[model samples]
Target: MVCMKDPTVQTICEIYEKLSKLDNLSPSKNVDTLFTQLVNTCIPPYPIDVTKLCTQIQIIRTKLIRLCGHAEGLLEKHYSTILGSFDTPLDHLYIFPYYSNYLKLARLEFDLLTQHCQNPTRFAFIGSGPLPLTSIVLASNHLTSATFHNYDIDGSANSMATKLVQSDTDLSNRMVFHTNDIMNVPGSVLKDYDVVFLAALVGMEIEEKMNVVEHLAENMAPGAILMLRSAHGARAFLYPVVEPRDLRGFEVLSVYHPTDEVINSVVIARKCPIPTVSSIDHQGFVTQMTCSKCAEIQVFNHQIEELAMEEHIC
Candidate 1:
């Protein structure tokens, strides 16, 4: 106002305000253009760290692209269902950015795990999506692993992960990729790992998630660490895609708020030793096992026969 607010300064300030409000944009055809403009204007000055700034912008752009892709894929895949018929653009946007939080939690978990690793340890990653890659990067940076096995149902995901890890010489020696259904992973096939990572796996349906957790619990060796990152809240307020169950045997190690809307919780549960039937008293309880171990009775039941066979053969 004093000097017409200096036109360039006014323009920059206007763009900054628009970018700040981009999160509030309603569903409209013009929203995309609004985001594009925001992205354009967020570019830093010429002397700034251009590579870092560009990477940040690309991350935001990638999030948007991934959201659109997921929405389109869901529509195509579930065309017969009511959800498939509904346009869920906002849902995609909401969940896509949550991965940024997931990445933050993953780094924390990786640091915690690395501090505890005394020997060469294998880390198995289930649902080897972007979050797992974040963990992989942390692991590589810290030189924490004996090796890494990344498993995903999507062949393309496996391929991408393999390519990414292989491109890094330090990570290349430590990472292997497996393209297969997580449900089909044999308990024996999973037993050697020291740590099992379940990132983004809980975002699946309840039954499927339980199945995956059950499988991980069964396959992991006693004393092995199972690290899980998932969206959590009471049922009503929680994300509806994946149902949250009681954490059960897992111990909540840390809960981090990486963003305003998203809370990333890291749970580290030691794979409790499955007590043999002979080890139980007449009441079918192991007197020495803790209350947490008692709660794991059902998980033990589902796994005992298979684990017994595995131990015998070994």
Candidate 2:
């Protein structure tokens, strides 16, 4: 637990209090000011035992996410209205102050994805909020030929996001929006995608984040690439962290923690093609074998017979 006497903790609490009451209206200068301060306050070299303060940190994280969501919504609405009056909406995308950030982040993800997938044709972006800037940036600047499927649970956010690109013919033809939870997406549909990106705020809690990762691992096509946003060091206070060990059905490829202004770390992994289970029987005998060339599996109990019932496992 974080001690109240800690100066950093006190400053963080004060900043959170101020941010909680900050105006969420468009042009949220005050909110941005406080958030900048919070970012500076959350710089690395945190006190020892930061893991013990997960609960407290999560409380602050939830508030921060809410604040960001509101600010994003306002900004999206403001831009959408302006774009509606223009002939080419995408031409003005750079007007957003943080547009370059999304551009850099998208380029980083693109470079990482290209390292493993030679020709990725389909991409599913989970938790794409009202702006869907990452998807827009990737579609507009990089991976121009790929089809993007943007998913968000909020109908209003989806409605707003659609407006941002509806007038742009290139994006409208390539970008698709769905208002549904990722868990509700069927495996049949998921199998069509070559890459899937999980947004940082999709699962704010560690358990929830792991559950989503496991779901993707279980449903995504074998050999499909899964990219997720994670945080390292003090950034964990703002976003949930995903350890490589937490990836059960996929083989982690790389974990990149940016020391620069980029907030979220990037994790890229590939779904294992085969399922091979190795478990010790009740009699203390160890059974281990690969189902096939690409199959890898892990049996929790002594259920050896169940392996034959399932065809292709991830």
Candidate 3:
């Protein structure tokens, strides 16, 4: 078994220690055993000290991301195993979902984005790992007019995702895959995309993120939406989530937290009439939006579904 020492780290810390040493980066009986334990431990956003739990989650996730690189493409390999075992992708999808339950976890985010963006026809999914569940959902759901483009840095993943799409002939036609590092992806390609999805687990550092933001700020067509998956509470432990500050180039339209679901949050942003020094006028402007009734923009509010009603911004 893999071994590491951490007095305060607890379960995930121990799991990380074991996982880091997986024989040749392949999942063995030990890996499956540990995965079972992990699923039970992390699911069910329990009513406990979430801050501590989330921190542990993030640490384990970050470590997995780092270790996956050396594991001979083993990170997403296990997911393939799981998918193959399923009778139909949708059979246990809502339950088992992706390895990290990313789609199920981010269900709230997707639901919220769909509600607000209504008829987005052009979509780009960045860092769509081997599974490409997000792209699959978008294509399958919006077959009428939506076009989904997927970009990934991993050549193997890009290839696998392409095949997965082709496996569903209908989906294949609507979705296009590209193997390109997010930092290297051309701004012109994303120029007309109505919506761009930046996965939370996207393996990118601060510098790369900055490069992407700057590129998008310069390239994405005006009025395009950037759907950023953000981590919150314990879900933040899963991946490097986005912060409002990271998206200075775009305007924050809304943030939605799917209650009783994943700990991650979603932020809907719009690139339009790029914020200028003048946008921040005297009465302490409300970042991207303005008060419809009065000048005082006191606080940020929840999304409509979350609050069961629309908020009056005044």
Compare the candidates by TM-score and give the number of the best one: 2
Q: Which stretches of candidate 1 lie over 4 Å from their true place?
A: 1-103, 114-120, 130-132, 233-262, 276-314
Give the least accurate 10-residue stretch of model 1, judged by summed lDDT: 234-243
What are the clash counts of all predictions, listed in order? Answer: 1, 8, 1
The candidates, ranked best first by TM-score, are 2, 3, 1
TM-score of 3: 0.69
- Model 3's C-alpha root-mean-square deviation from the true structure amounts to 7.6
> What lDDT does candidate 2 reach at residue 266?
86
Model 2: residue 229 alpha-carbon error in angstroms: 0.4
Which segments of model 2 are wrong by more than 4 Å?
Answer: 22-27, 43-49, 54-78, 276-280, 283-314
**Total backbone collisions, model 2:** 8
**TM-scores of the models, in the given order?**
0.53, 0.81, 0.69
RMSD of 2: 10.3
User: Whole-model lDDT, candidate 3?
Assistant: 0.59
Candidate that beats the other on TM-score, 2 or 3, i.e. the better one: 2
lDDT by residue (tens digit), candidate 3, 1-314: 12223323356566667777666656567765765555445444433332344554555666654553334246455565466455454334444334344645344455556655778888888888777776776565433568888888778787766655555556768888888876776667778788988876564344556667667776787778888665543344343556666676677777654444354567777775543334565887754542111111112233444444233111
Q: What's the C-alpha lDDT at position 198 in model 1?
A: 77
For candidate 2, list the clashing residue pairs, or say none: 274-294, 274-295, 274-296, 275-295, 275-296, 275-297, 276-296, 276-297
| Model 1: lDDT of residue 219 | 63
lDDT score at residue 26, model 1, on the 0-100 scale: 36
